[model samples]
Target: MRPPTRLARAGGALLLAAALSGSLGGCLSAYLGTAPEENSPTAPPSAPPGPRTTAPTGAAAVTAAVTVTIGNFLFQPANFTVRPGGTVTVVNGDTVEHTLTAQDRTFGTPPIAPGASATFTAPAQRGDYAYLCTFHHFMRGILTVA
Candidate 1:
């Protein structure tokens, strides 16, 4: 067969470049933690792979003084109550950095790296405070200070 024409060679180069760019884009997104995981809130819930916490059985057993676990892009014990101005511990169990920020600016924690932890004091006021992860807004929880 005759050698490929100039147009054919250019087309092949363009196709190769497009494929390389697409693959690089995917790698970058994964590295930046922008790629959605299977357990993301937008997807149907699946059994998380790890030890799980059981809900308290009685009202008296309920306690917000426990540590908040972040994994699978979710906040375990998504709602709880604590004493006013009480310090709350947040554990980042996911593979990405996360922040627990109050919607009303009452309380928040700086970015907690994966497997790291941080703490923030609850507002002294008695009310329900909604919070979310600054990096992943869909990951939300409620803090009640009573």
Candidate 2:
């Protein structure tokens, strides 16, 4: 065959080989369940177990405090459940100011001073109440009265 014709044939063979190799590689990967390097080998550990509460010893049982920490513009216990008419003392340990305003019946503290504490008694009904820090819109929490 002429030089030009031979060169064209060689180029076509190389192209066909490259295409076959790519398709075979894809099929092999799918069969082996091999993922890219970034894919984690195993699912990351789940979040630590739920919040742990210290049971009241003696008189403390009568007056239990469900502390809702406020820091980094977040409520540590973003969601919590409490017995109706129970007492919830929200302590603001953050350096910034925070407020706990109830969505409905004004069942919240005025502005809990930073490094200071304030308490609010739940109503006599069962419902989910959302609270937030008016000063910082991002700070929010939920109180499930049961």
Name the best candidate (by TM-score): 1
Per-residue lDDT of candidate 2, residues 60-113 (tens digit): 343334777777778878887677788887778888778877866469887988
In model 1, which regions exceed 4 Å deviation?
1-64
Residue 101 miss distance in model 1 (angstroms)? 0.6
User: Which ten residues in a row are the worst by lDDT in model 1?
Assistant: 55-64
Q: Deviation in angstroms for 6 in model 1?
A: 64
Against the true structure, whose lDDT is highest? 1
Model 2, clash count? 0
lDDT per residue, candidate 1, 48-120, as tens digits? Answer: 6997797554555535565899999999878877777778999999999998899877689999999999998
